[model samples]
Target chain A: MSELAMHEIDRLKENLAERAAAEGLIDVSYRLVDSPVGQLMLAATGRGIVRVAFAAEDFDAVLDSLAEKVGVRVLHRAAPLDAAAMQLDEYFAHARTGFELNLDHRLSSGYRLEVQLALPRIEYGHTASYKAMAAVTGRPAAVRAVGTACATNPLPILVPCHRVLRSDGSLGGYLGGLDAKRALLSLEQDPFGN
Target chain B: MRLHGVKMKTNPPFELVVREHGPAVLRMCTALLRPGPDAQDAWSETFLAALRAYPGLEPGANVQAWLITIARRKAIDSLRARHPVPVDSLPEQAAPIDGFGPDGLFENAGLWDALGTLTELQRKVIGYHYLLGFPYAEIPGFLGGSAASLRRAAADGIKSLRKLLDVSEES
Candidate 1:
């Protein structure tokens, strides 16, 4: 039904995306990236990466929350997420250990955000107890709160929330399910073997 | 990274809507406003408006029809915003776009020129019905006329195009 050349449509979409960003009509840009874990939906604002969702998480529900919590101008454009996508690809390929990507922390706040921000310091291939996370956040008495923080982490793999374990060194709850948590930990422990 | 199977959602990302209907909307705008900043503005405005209101759209709403309605309104708004210089009194029109050559809508310059010769109603009728595949019965609501008159306009528009492009005698 389209008499316009395919390239013309593509060009128009590109132009619209650029114009939308220029006009601030685009607050959140997102796209799906496939990783070893599963299909990941990555979303970002002009500020930084805002939300990351595993396939197990209902993408529609995630999008609705982003619209409600962030802004209604979320688009499925990939430009803003290009860096995150590349880094994620490298991560899945075992070529990267730390994420140097810019993160927009607006989706989180208070103790939850504090716990999530401290997750990267746990070091790659190393696991930490929720008690340790609470201690790191200077809330040594809030071990349960630390667990809640890791459980509700908005950034997921990017924030390394899977690094947090129970005090007895047991695999704790993961938003992406236990298997995904195990897989990520194993990937970090022995990148080439798994 | 491995391409893991995606869990399907009944509600697709908004980009799919843009990709699906963008070209047709652009073509409609070109036919309605011709190739220029005006057409581009109408196109951009339509999609921006659509994107803002998308989350609240009814689950099974007719997406293309809804977009067409918005595009038509945006085109009308653009037309109204233009300075009312008489078509005959205006200076010779400059080239509409710089790089919209082989990659854009007016690659068939002759066809675009032919389309320009038709009356506004003829152009809209031809664009909505023939180019964008809008039902004949539905053309009236967007462009305003009975279906019967729109069908006549479509026929007359094509006749004019055939004559202007000099394909009638060959056939």
Candidate 2:
């Protein structure tokens, strides 16, 4: 074959590879949610919610993290999160109060799990101090530790760490940011208020 | 404030739209700006802006194009803020090519180095069209120019790069 023909063949192969890779990426299910804090992109495996990211966060990181955790290459598609996105839209619209979807909690580890386990118990329109959360976890003096746990909570709003507050009736630090914390608190008080 | 009333109307099923477009937008940003911390920051900001404006997107529109445009604007703003001097200002080092096959087509590190020498706009056009396989029509919308202008920009950029790389290959 002539060099030009060889080049043409090479180009065709490259195009085929690129198409296959793109098709693979498009196979993953995806959705967006109007969370109290901001718009969120959610990705899921066949198991459960694999990744969630704020619009501002590097979404590639979320996908990469999911790929690492699931031990499979995550294809980017919007089908999986369709139900979750609807539920989230309802939650934001004040038509719903809680998310009832199955979650893949494999990413939560150690102290983060302890904090997350304490989150759902934090009733809507209410708050819990870090000390209170620590006390509930049978580590009464580990308020700082509980705060660290909250900071590391991978699922954020889903885990309800925003309900964990400072001991002094002030808002504590949130992994998603203070504005998110405030929005969640405000939404709980009056889901339609924000 | 009633200014909140002006918030864009968000369509239902928000996560799906974001997931589909997120990687493309990230790729665009990475192509436009230097990879690393700054690009990461810009990526996040772009998504935040998208989230805030999600409610306003019309149903069944091209969400990928919309997100890419937002990312492109955010990247430009970041470049302005950081005032990344010039591509030539940095040392002329080549990025190691990964995931290439045995064909040796990508082994030409000098070609990539020459590509790096182009202006930020030129580099972005090349990356999006040649590397990422985005359609030529989409280039104008992302770069905020006419389709003809984008085509010319891409052609000129490629011509300049071939010359630069050819010289380097001879050396």
Candidate 3:
């Protein structure tokens, strides 16, 4: 497309996004935010932030999942995600230790929700074992389930799933992959359960 | 690794759908109506409507055709809203075509006027067949005309458009 055509179409899309959002036509709004780990695709519902996806997860696939799992009225507007994006930027800069944003946990439920909800209490610069997390959730025998919760955490950083580790203190699996897990843990200056 | 090679029937993200088809839909809207607020509204309405109904659409469906169908409907609705009385055809206008207005959208005012001079059916045929390149056979299903008749309409529309554009250029 020519520059003039591109400008006109962008104006049209911006107008559409605003009007659709005001009229209650937007079901999911999303924007991409940069982080120490990589570019993150943040998507939210009317309730709160829903999914924060890594670039490696394939943004197109992530959006498809959002459309299928949430609502199909997905748009690329940054208004709803501005607070979350700003906070994330602050966190990456080591200026913020915790999130003050509303989160939508519709993507997880039951034991997963229980496990994820307990993660924030782990504190910055501290790691918790899956076995310990299971015990904290009152399911000491479901250490594997705790691992599953961390592995499939719909909201990764904000929920702090990277804090969960193996009983031996080895890095466990993470939804954003183990490398991202290491990057986030080091960024927090993880003292390894100290 | 075993499952990586398997073919999945995943629906494309709606974002991709909009990115790929948005420009064409906007162009179609402007051609169907004049490029301005009304045309922009029709483009937005078409996408919103498409997004609402997109999940139910078949995976093998022709996306462009589906979008153009929606665009046409939204454009007609816009026309209806602007004119209270049923506008079967546009009345002949004797006013000289204006040059570009303050709004950037009016840059193509002459072309828009030339398009406006074509009859509704002729305009539809020319826009769909020549501008957007919808095949004659495919157009009948949406526009409700025989392929033979549509071909004739397009020919006549093209002739009139050429004459109008030539006159505008000379003056």
DockQ for every model comes to 0.17, 0.02, 0.33
Alpha carbon lDDT of residue A5, candidate 1? 63
lDDT of 1: 0.76
Q: Give the candidates in order of lDDT, highest first.
A: 3, 1, 2
lDDT values of the candidates?
Answer: 0.76, 0.61, 0.76
lDDT of 1 by residue, B1-171 (tens): 112244322334566678667766776688877576777788889998887777677654666767866776686566546633222221112122222221233335556667778898998776655444456676575666799999999878878877776665345
**Over the stretch A41-88, how does candidate 1's per-residue lDDT look in tens digits?**
999988899999998998877876786677656677888898999998
lDDT of 2 by residue, B1-171 (tens): 113224333332433444444444544455566865566666667765665565456644555556655765676567547553333222112221222111121334455456667777788776655543445665564566776787788778867875775534233
Residue-by-residue lDDT tens digits, candidate 2, A1-194: 35753454344333322343444422235556666678887876556775566765656556545544553333334556777788777766777777787777777777767778778898767888898888898889888888888887766666678888888989978756788778777888996654
Q: What is candidate 1's TM-score for chain B alone?
A: 0.51
TM-score of 3: 0.73
List candidate 2 stretches off by more than 4 Å: A1-36, A192-194, B1-171
Please identify which of the two predictions, 1 or 3, would achieve the higher TM-score against the true structure: 3
Where is model 3 chain A poorest over a 10-residue stretch in terms of lDDT?
Answer: A185-194
List residue ranges in candidate 1 displaced over 4 A: A1-11, A191-194, B1-42, B49-70, B77-171
Worst 10 residues of 2 chain A by lDDT: A12-21
TM-score, every prediction: 0.64, 0.48, 0.73
